[model samples]
Every structure is written in C-alpha cells, then in structure tokens.
Target: MSAQFELPRDGVTRIMAAPPRLNLRRAASYQNDKGPLSSTSSRFNFNHLVFSPPPSPGLPPPLVTRPRKLSNAPRPSRVFRFVFWVASLVAFLYVASLFARRFVGHVPSVMSWAIESQDEYEMVGQDELPDFPTPIAVTDVHGRSKWTVSIPPTHTFPLSVQEYADMCAQCHEVAVHVRELHGESTSKQQARASYYYRDPYFVDVGEAESHGLLPGFSKTSKATGRSLAKPLIGESWDYMVEKPACKTSLTFVLESADGGLGTTLMLLWMAYGLAQKEGRAFFIDDTRWAYGRYTEMFQPPPPADCVPPPRHEMLPCPHGARHLVVSAGTARDTFGPAFTAQFEDVRQDSIERERPLFNLARVGYEALFRINKDDRPYVMERIEELKLKTTHGTNGDAANSTIIGVHVRHGDVHPVEYQYNGAYIPLTIYKERIQQAAVAQHNRAMPESVEPAPAPLVVLASDDPRVFESEEFSGVIRAQERIKLAGKVPVVQPVLDKSVMHPFKEEAVGWEGGFFRVMFWNLGRPSIASKQTQISLAPEATKLRAFIGRAYVMDLAVLGATSDVMVCTISAMGCRLLAVMMGWEKAMVKEQWVNIDGDYSWVAL
Candidate 1:
C-alpha cells in the first residue's frame, strides 16, 4: 500500500498507491467529445477546460491556437477565364496595331503628301504644257543615254532696256485706254497692269548731284551758234543755243573682239572711271560686233540721260569736242591720271590690256570702282528681284545669310583652245578648300562672345552636275562629321531640269561639258567666222539664257554678301566678275589652280 494524505480544501497534497501502467493501445484509443481537431472544431468546452503547458526552456514556445483557414470563395469558370484571356489578347493586339499604323507603316508626312498630290494633279492635265514642250530625245556619239541631250520648247529672248521701257509705256497706255473705256479707277488700272513688268525707281538727278556722283565738266565745246530744238513737253519746235559749249559727253566703244563678259565689264568700269573723273555723262555702245552680240544677250540699263535742252537721241560726243579713244591695251596709262589735273588734254587715245585694270599704287581697287552710296539701294533691290525670279528651290535663307560662293569651270575648259585645258580638279580639293574658307569666314564673322558661331552657307555654281555626286560635295550637304568646318555647313545649288532647252551636240562641239550647252541651245548651223556669227538659238534659248543669267547674278550677289572671303578657280571669269562687282580686295579673293595631275591648290588672285 502507498501512504495517502489530504490537505485542506484550498490546496491539496495526496499520495496514492501506484496503479498498473495503462495499456498503450487503450490510451491511444481514447477520443474527445469533439471530433478530430479541424477547421470545424469549436473553442467552447462542456467540461472543465485544460490549459496548454509551457514550452521547454531550450526550445521555442509552442503555438496556442491553430491558424485560421482562408475562405473558400468560388473560382471563376474555365470558359469565362478563357474568354477574358482572349479579350485581353485582342485588346493588346488592337493597341499594337494602332501604334504601328501611326508610326511604323509607310506613312508620309503632311508636306510630302501635299507635294505628291499636287504633282498628281498637275500630271492629270490634258492640254500640252506651256513654255515646256516634250523633251526631244537625242543620242550621243556613244549611242548611250548618259550623254544624250534633250531639247525643250523654244521661248522668247529677254527684253532690252529700250524694249522694257517701251513695254512699260505700252502697259500704261493700255491701262489708260481700259480706264477710259470702262470708267475704272487708276488703282484698278494699275492692278490690272501689274503683271506685265516692274518699273524701277527713277533716280533723282538732284540727289545724285548732292552725293557728288555727277561727273564734272572742265572744258566747253567750240561751236557758238543757235540751233532749233523741240519744246520740252510738246512736239513744237523752238530755236535754242547751237551746239552747247560744254564737254559733257563721254562715249565708250567696246571692241568687237573682246568677247568675254568679264572683259566687257572691265571696259565699262574704265569708261565709268573716265566719266566720273571728267564730270561727263557716259555711254557704252556694245551694239556692233562680237562683244555687241554678247551684250545683246543681257538686258542692261540704258545710257544715263540727265542733260537739259538740245538732248541728243542717243548718247553722243559733244560737237567739235576733242575725243578720247582708248583701247584695251592703253587703259592703265589712260586711267592713271584721269582723276588728277595731269589729265587736262581734251583728246587722249589710250589703250588697255586684255586683263582686268588695276589702280596705280595710290588708289585701291575698291576706290576705283566704288559704287556710289545712292546706287546701293537699287543694286540690292535688283538682286532681290533676280533671286525671286531665278532660284528654283528655296534659297531665301541663303540669299539673306552669310554664304561662301564656289565657281567651278570644267565644261569648255576641257577644250585645248580654252585657257584651262586639261585641268580637272578632284572634288576633294574643292571640299577641303571650302571647309578652310568656311572656317576662316566663321572665325572672322564670329563676335567675341560665349554663343556659338553661325555656320556659313555654301553656294555652288558649276558647269557639271556631276560635282554634286562627289563625296565631298554630298558630305557638305549632309554636314558630315569628317568635315573640319567649325559648324555644320549647308550647300545650295540650282536645279537643272530636262524640260528646259539645251544646246545640241554640234553646237557644243568644243564645250561638251560646259554650262553653255545646258543654258543655250544652238538652232542654226555654225557660221564661217565663229567670232562674228550671231548665235541663232531655239525660241526657248532666249528664256533659258535670261533665266541662267539671273541665276548666275543671284549667285554672285550671295557671294558678295558674304564675309569678304571667296574661293574660286583661276580660270573662272564669272567668279572674277563677281569679285569685282562686290568690290572685294585682291587679297580677299582666293584663286584655286589645278595641276597636270588633276590636283588642286590655292593662291591669291
């Protein structure tokens, strides 16, 4: 037996005899009133409750309660899920398609679309095109299309100075007639006649005199007799002073043999110098021979007529007045003392050289042909008009901005008779030279400031279109990194079209690759005396010539507007003419030469 003791009711201590060990199988078989511990088990108990025991000291505390289970919400059906996934996929595809359509497909820009639409509409016209006829296909000597030339419809020549004035008069007359017949206002008449031609501003003689632009007169004529003259406003006749005694007229006769445009311009300059020195009105007569023919090609201004009564129909030498007949060979000596008192002789026969005239050591070239301040406005206006009429593409920015002009002579120069025969300059040389010039010009034009300098624009005038195909030329257009220009440089050139009339193979025999062939088409047979023969061209030749001339003039204007740095080929007379027009110093103009090996180098002209 085992001893047993009982304590008071509040606390108990008991000893009892040890019972037999309970059967392990029977203990395991015991079950609680509640079923197995599961999510459905209740926390409340019917009998006395038992608490959990403490965890062992070395182990983590045991959990007091089982974890709450997540709610069994019903899952979506398979069909619904499939439909939802398909709809999501379709939405994603639709969005991707829209994005691709907006940005990835063959979508054209608004400008491009508009241009294309315009071109299509133009092609849909039924009647034959005006000004430009069907291109006359011609085969070259090699029977290849590459060298083939196309002749376009003929056009009329440019209006001469007299012809232009007459046309203006006719327009005014027509407008007046229309107004009288229809009782229209003067403004309406002007509007109706506006398309015919532009009337240049009349230069005021008084203003010219105030600016010291009028020529001076040192001597008087010997004739002292009365003469009959027409009334100022009407056709009535009146008696006037006979053969006014004043050395007020100077006439310059350009030689027929001087065919080059540059030579002609030099002669004009010489005549201008003499007139300015002697204070005499000047006249240029280029209407007789070779130079005359060339002169006729352009529509130059008429002789200045500012004299009072007894006005001669054409500019004429004063009666009984000593004449100064100067040739190209004696120009230097003749003009040397022209501005000084040493040139007192009334009659001086001076000759000039075949080259451009330069001033003596004292007078600078700029001072020699310096344009009067009054003439600047006219020149600028003329240039603006020419640019608007001639430039094919958008050259608005270039016309107003800093531009470096490059004149390349490669067409007629290929002929042995040409001054620069066998001289072919590679495109790289031009590119390098242009780059250097651009850099220099930029540096000179840039102000000492923190802002980056504006890159200069390049205007390329060349006889051959192949120059554009060169890596160097294209690189400039694309503004490649390899070019050493301080800033990106852009290049502009005239676009030549096939519809325009061009010279035939026979007409361009010597100058097969020249701009003349593209600009003028010879329609008649070659004359015996090539120099004396008049160039008979297709009706369209005149229009083309005028267009090309205007374009060339605009190019020069652009160059002149630059920062006084010009890079040009030595053989390119056009470039020299532009330099002279711009009043550029000899040091400012750079001449490029081509060696026998087709290499290019530069020197001051």
Candidate 2:
C-alpha cells in the first residue's frame, strides 16, 4: 500500500515509510539501508544505542599524540650467536659420532663369526710360531658337546746349545710322508726336514747362532764389557731367571694352553697398547725382545688376486699368509658344504680318536719372520693353493678332533615369503646334538670326557623367534617353536646375559635368506676341545654380527675403509682388514638396514 516518506538531514540519510495497519500478535520484520556501512553492519543495529548529544559545539577533537619508535630496543649479541653455532656444530658432531660408533662396533663380532664359520670351525690351523709371530685372540669355543682339551706344555728346558739342538731336532724331524714330498731333491728336503730341527721348539739356543740374514746385536753386559757368553740355565730365557718367593722363574717357559704364545703375545700387546695410549694403535719395541727380528721379517706381502682354480679345484692359505680368512667348500661354493654335512657323523667317529701332542715349534720361526713383509708373496701363493684344495674337499685324515667347525646354513632360496621367514630351534636341541657328537667321538676313542656339560655352542641366526615375540606379534610362541625346530635344537636357552638381550636384540625383518658358515680352530692335530658357543641373531642383527666377522679377512691392503659407515671407531689397520674381508665376501655381505639420514651408503669391509 502507498505510504508517506521522510528523510534525515545529514550527508548520510535514510527514508522511512509509514504502514497503514499493524498486527500486534505477529512478529515484525524491517529492512536496513542499502549502503556499504549498512550491509557491513547487517547483524548489528547502529541506531539501537541511545547516547547523550555531543556537548554544545562538539568537544574539541580528542587530543592526539605521536607514538614513540621501537628501533632502540635491546637485541641479541654476536657472542650469543657464536655460542649457538658452536653448540650446534658440537651436537651435529656428537650425533655423527654415535652413527660412526654404531657402524664400526659391529666389525669384530662379524669378523669372529666369519672366522668361526669356516670348515676348520673348531680347528684353526697351526700357525708357524717362528714364521708368523703376531698374536691373535681366538674366540673361545661354546656348547660343551665334545671333549678335546688343549694339551699341556711338553718341556721347559734351559736355553743352551745342547738343549736348543735337542729341542730343534724334535720339531725339525721329518716324517716319511714329508720326505716323500721332497722326493729327489735331497738339498730341498734337507731344508724342509731341518726347518723344524735346527731350532728347539722352546729354546732359542740354536737361533742365536744358526738362522741367517737377520739383524745382529752387540750387547755389553752391564757388569762386564764382554759379551754375555754363558747360557743362563734359568727360567724365562729373555730375562735372567729370577727367584721369586717360591721358585726361580724358568728361562724359556713353555706356554701350555689353548692359544700358547700367540694368544699371550696378543694379550700383552693389547694390554700394553691400552696402558700406553688412549686411542693409539697397538705397537711393540721390536728391538728389545725375541720378536724384534721376527716383526721385520714377517711384514705383510703384496696383494695377490690369484688366478681362479680350474672348475674342479680349490685352495687354502699358505702357512703364513697374514690377513687370511680360510674357507673350505665345494667348487661351486666358497664354504665347505661337505664338511658341514659331516658334522653329525663326526660325533659318531670320535669314540676312538687319538690324543694329540702340543708343540710350539713354529714360535721361533714365527718370531724370526713375524712382521717381515718380504715373505708375503710365497705365503699368499701358498694360501691360494690351500683355498683351492679345501674347496675340492680333503680325505679322511683331514678329520680330527683338533678340527672344530661351525656350520652356517643358508635357508632354502625359494618362495619369496619363505625367504623372509625365520625358524626357531631350542637351545636344548643344539646341546643334545653336541652331547650326541661327544658321545660318538668318545665311542670312536677320540678321547671324549664325561663332564656335566656347560654352554659351548654360539648359534647365530637371522630369524630368532625370541626377538619376534617381543614385538607383540600374536602367537609368538608358535613362531618361536617353528624356528627352534628348523634350527635343529630343542632346548630353548639364551646364551647372552639377559640384560644384554633387549639392547642387542637381533631380528630378521629384512633377511633375504639364510645361509650356513663354519669357523674352525685347529689345535695341533687333534687337540680340539676349547670353549665353544652358538649365537643366533635375526637378519638385521646378523649384518652387524657379520661385520664383526669381516676382521678375519687377512688381506689388509685390499681391505680399506669400505665399511666406514658400519663403524665409528676402530684402529686404522683393523678398519682396513674389515674392509678387505667384506670385499672378499662380495654379495654375501649383509645389507645395511640402519643408516644416517638417507644419504650415506655402507660398503664391504
């Protein structure tokens, strides 16, 4: 309907229309002005508030004031920035240091495994004490399944001309078999036959006068300006025999233990190293003791990637090849499958095994050439030949208690799912197997003893059921049981201290497949019993452990810092050997699942 309209007077205005009729009971609706301000205030009524009219002529515009500038405010200092940068750098380094440490720490263990996984598993060959003098620590045996104790010292004679000659004759005496090898060349065989004879196994009496081409010492005894002419028939040949509280320490004391002089020397060297330097490499005064000339003579030989053997052949390390990791296997493989297959049977044959004699005949020669790098070529060539021979397999005589082995079996390589899968075998089963082997060896007259067994075998596996169960997966027991069965062990015993288990837990989430490796320690012919144990780790842990195994690879020049990422701190020489061994293993080495960020990659030992 038409209505009257009125308008406001200010520049901003609005019109009003009057309605003819009103419905008091109905809700009222009103429209607002069609301006920007009105639209912006659509939800608010600008006219709703009543205010007193501005004073008479509008009070003077509210007093205005300029705000002060904030440019003069205090700021952080340069020193603070510098300190921050330094702290950041340190933190970065600290983290990197941790990463490096994690990488390098795995090396020794991996190296140990590699060495123990060879065909000689329990029987590391007899190192020539005279030709190769560096001491090495052999991993103690695990799983008390057999009894072949290391022999005791055979003699402790005074270091004298006659005593020396007699001692030398014992080791140098040639057997008919060795004589046959020499065949027609009496001169050549003379050297071979006399090699062990000219010097006594324990006394250096003959060495002072007979060995050729070595440094000479002109000693003026402190008491007299003359040479120390007479042989002192005292204990400990290097030093004058000393009588402690009870008895005189003998000259040329015979080392009577599992490792003999080699181990003792290494321990001494290590102890000396630790005592002298915080982070320095191991060293010794070569000029002071019997090892002086030996170190100079046994320096490592040059690197040699020998020609591959014919399809059917195999070879092993020469007697003194340094940085060596020997394996016995078939032509198609790099480790001994035949030896592994015989593990079970060896126990059966041990019943009538003969006792072995302990000998340190090689010690003097080892001391003579210990670090001399010149003999390396011949040593390497011989080593290559040995490797090839071992690959082709050896006859029954090769089987002896002195030969201890660990069989690392790779899992079946079919069906991708199975490849990632792990099996569990109870520790009891392994123990039983060891017991059975011991029984068999005893039955065979191999000198087995009936002692209540202690832990002797260390089993390493990629898929350990125990670890999987910890992740809270369902039915872990079933999985663990399955693995135990596959492992061929029935008793479920944990070898490591329980405290170390959680932190060192090994799992197999990424183990592509499982493979078998064996480590051997030959204790002079048939003296095989020493400490033994088996450890099983899952795939991820296996890689770490395998890195430790890499140390046994003997070619240092070839083995550099390829595994720099795998380790944080290790002696430079140790690093080199680790790298070389990893290189030797090639594809068999484990993949690095753990890493720093996503950039760096891990290489072979």
Candidate 3:
C-alpha cells in the first residue's frame, strides 16, 4: 500500500498517486478563480487593499489644487463714494478758477481798442474826457449851459498857485497831508513848496504876461493888461490858432558839441517858440548831429495835424526860405538876435531884476515836452514790452516790483584827462548817495507810524559798461545789505547781460558820416576785433551806434517805469530826462557838481 495522506478539512483521507489524470472539472475551477471580483457592497471587504499599476513614460504628471477661503468684509456705501467724488471735483474747479483769475488780472487790456470805441459808447469829445471830477453839464456864472470841456493834464501849465497846490495834493498825499497835520513844521515841506513855486505849472499866466515873462512881449503893450481867460501868445490855444499857413515854411537847425537829450529838448523848444512867434511852419534838422539813436528806437506817433519833414531829407526847408541856424551853446545875446532884442527892451525898464527871457524859454520847454495823447498808447506798450524784456525769469515778478533806477553816465562827457573825468566817480560816493536816497524815499512813501515800504530793486543804467565793472557795482550791493542791517528789507540789483546793449544797426550817413561814428570815434581809440567803440575801425561805427543807441533807449524806458527815487549823476542829460519822464524830479540829488568846463557849478536844463 502506498503512503496514506490525511486532509484536515473534514477528516478526509487520500492516497498519493503519481498524478491524477487531467480532468475537465478541475481545469474549470482554476479558470473561475482568476476572474474579477464584484464591485457591489455585498462583495466588498473594508480591510482589503489593492495596488494600482505604474503610469506610462510619455504622460504628464497628475495636478494638485489648493482650497480657497471666502472673505466677509463689507463694501463701501454708494452715497459715501458719490460724496467723495463730488468733493474732489469741486476742489479741482476751485483751483482752476484761481488760476483763471490770476491770468485775467495779469493780461493788460488793449487800450487802443477801448479808446477807438469811445465815440460809440459815449458822445464825449477827446478834450471832454475828464482828468479830474467835473459836472456833467458845465455852466457859466449866469447858470446857462456853457460848453462842457475838460482840461487835460497837459493843460495844467500856467496854473495858479492854488491850482498847483490842489494838483500836488492829488498826486502826493503824504507830502501834502503830513505837512498839513504837523502845521507845516517840517523843513522838507518848505523846501518842496519853494520848488513848486519855481515850477512852470505854478506860474500865473496873466502875471507872467504883465511882467513881460515872455518873448516878443512889450511891457507897455495893451495886450499885457488883458484878462487871464483870453488866449495869449505862447499858450497852447494861441499856438493852435496861430499856426502858420500850409504854404509858408521855416527850418531850424540845432548845433551843439555837448548838448544831450535835455539840452537838445530845450533848444528845440526855443525854436518852436520862435516859429510860433513869427507864424512860420517849422521843421527840425538833426542830420548833422542828433539824438537819432534815441529817437529811432521808438516809433512815436506822428504829429496830429502836421506832417513832419522826412528823416532822409537834408534840406527840410522850402527851396527859397532862409534857414535859421542857431548854435545852442552861443551867448544869450547872440543866440537869436531878433527874439533877444524884445527881451532886452523889456529888461531895460523892468523893476524886477530877474531875467524874464530865461523864464519864457523854460515855460515853453515844459509845454513842448508834454507827451501828446496819440503818443500815450505807444508809450504804454513800449513800457510793458521793455519791462518784460529787461527783467529776468519767466514768472515776471521783477517787472512789477518797485524799481530804484540808478543811471551813471560816463564816456565823452568832459575832462577826460583829470578833474572831471566822467568815469572818475568813486564807488564809495555812489554807495553813500544811493543809501541816502533810498532812506529818504522810504520815509516819504509811508506815514510816521506805519511800517516801511517794501525795499526797491536797484536797476543800473550806464553809458560806459566800465561804470558797472568798477567796484562801485558791488558797493551798491553792500549798501543794500546795510539797509537790511538797519531793520529794513534788502534789495537786489538785476543781473544784466552784455548782449542787451545792441538791438539795432545804424545805416544812414550824413554830413557827419553817421552821428554815432563821429561822436564815438572822438571818445577813445578803436579796437579792431571787438567791433565796438575803442575796439574797432571807424567803419564799424554803424555797429557801435546801433549798440549804444539801443542801450540808451532801453535805459530810458526802464527808468520811465520806475516807481521810486533815482540816484544818478547830476550832470548827466540821461538823468534829467529820466527824472522828467518818471516824475521823480524831487528825488534827484542837488549836490554841487561841474560840467565839461571846469566851472564848479553846473545845472541840467
């Protein structure tokens, strides 16, 4: 018997055989065991685990994602957002309006346009435009409507003492009001009153005529006793009425070696007086030597009624008329014999020793020099333009600031070698003068109890650039510093570039081969490379003239717009002209000074 085998399942016994023959039932059972398991819950096992197959080499890796958290913050309200936006818009508009107002304030209106429309808007004549307050309807003593006319500022000449005092009160409140409050105790007020009396404005027209304070006036003449209201010779009304006929012509030549703008103006006024007295058409011949450089810088309005002679015409007089050639520097007796003879006759019998002829010329000069209405607009425009051009920076604050004009004239004035060299003024002298002037001006502008005025900016004008190159320029700066140390605000001097000197070129040539060339060539030696006086050949005179002429005009315009005192060389014609234009006559220094002649005393015209 073969070895017996026991089965533990149910106590079954089986004999081990070499191999049980292959049965179909056994093969079927083996195949069933390899089949897939059921996915239903009934066949699932909780503890059983299964493994997944590896991924293919070419595939992408699996993606992992993070969970997000939800926010609970509250959003802004609609009303709050709307209110915020409205506030921002209002702020933007307010800022914009401020800028608009500033722009409107800065831009000057076109005065020409306003003047042109005067006829349409109002039925007033140019002469009827009120300078001072006047009634709408003017009447005589009888209460009947007389002609309604306005007296212009220019017509204030020959004003009475009372009228002058009234005008002074209007123009200068501090001078008049302060003195009146103090019972006129200040010496300054007395000095100013004396000056006012001497001014042409305060002269009594009737008294002046009776005293024979005019040319061609005989003391015994019946006309001298006429009423003051009636028009008189040398007056504007008389000048207008007695102008020469169109056919008659007269020429006046002004000849002088050292006469500048002031002297030339005085001479021109004398010529005008003679022309009016003789009833002859007048013209000025300045071709030989003239202030052409200054005159040409501005395009002054043409004379209202007269056609002046052409600039290029050397002979302005009519073909047959005799020319009256007068040397401005000649003795009074020989200056104009025909006119002088009448004064001599009056002087012989006059009780007052004062020279009436001199007073007549002075009065005429003031009248002729009054700026005309037509020229006013041009002057305003030029002043604005120059104020912009001369000042630095884009904001243009300097243009509006108070300007203290300092004009130092040097070069070719007189005594080039020694005693009176124009450029010989010491820096210390200029500093002291400027400081004193500034202080006086400050005191005059404000009341005693009030704070001082804002410090004025100093504007330098000089014929010789060397005047500025001197230590005096820096000395002026130090003077400003001294003002600050004295508890006042400090001022700064403008930094002017050298290029401002040249703005035009001279082209015209005359008997003198161009006024600039002849005048400057005698000033100093010429330099070849610089093309300026003392720096070039005589042919370059045109360039030199252009440079100096433009600079001179620029200086005048700058000085004209200044608001405060002007410290200047007393003998300089430029200083006098500036004082007249800017109405700063009282501020000028009255120190003892000399001219080209070694005469210790000299007075500007």
lDDT of each: 0.38, 0.25, 0.39
My TM-score estimates for the predictions, one after another, are: 0.37, 0.18, 0.37
TM-score of 3: 0.37
lDDT of 1 by residue, 1-605 (tens): 96557677877765564432422222212324334555465633422233322333455656334333344754568678989999999999978855654445312111000013312211122222222211111112222111000111122122123322232233233324324544667775556432112222111222222222221111242112112222121112223623333345554544423323444455555555655555655444443323223333333323344422222211111111222333343333334332222333335332112113333211222322333243334446644543443233243333323345566666544423244366565667666776676555555555464543344455565555556555666622211111111212334545668899865433223323445532233323244434544555544544444434444444444455532445565556555455455442433233221222233321112
Candidate 3 residue runs with Cα over 4 Å from true position: 1-250, 254-262, 273-280, 290-323, 327-402, 414-423, 450-454, 474-519, 522-540, 543-547, 582-605
Q: Specify the highest-lDDT model's number.
A: 3
lDDT string for model 3 (74-97, tens) is: 456867898899999999997885
For model 2, residues 417-489, the per-residue Cα lDDT tens digits are: 2322344233343334444543443344433645432222111222222433333222111201111312233
Q: Sort the candidates on TM-score, descending order.
A: 1, 3, 2
Clashes of 2: 163
Model 1 worst lDDT run, 10 consecutive residues: 106-115
Pick by lDDT: 1 or 3, better one? 3
Error of 2 at 316 (Å): 15
* 10 residues in a row with least lDDT, candidate 2: 351-360
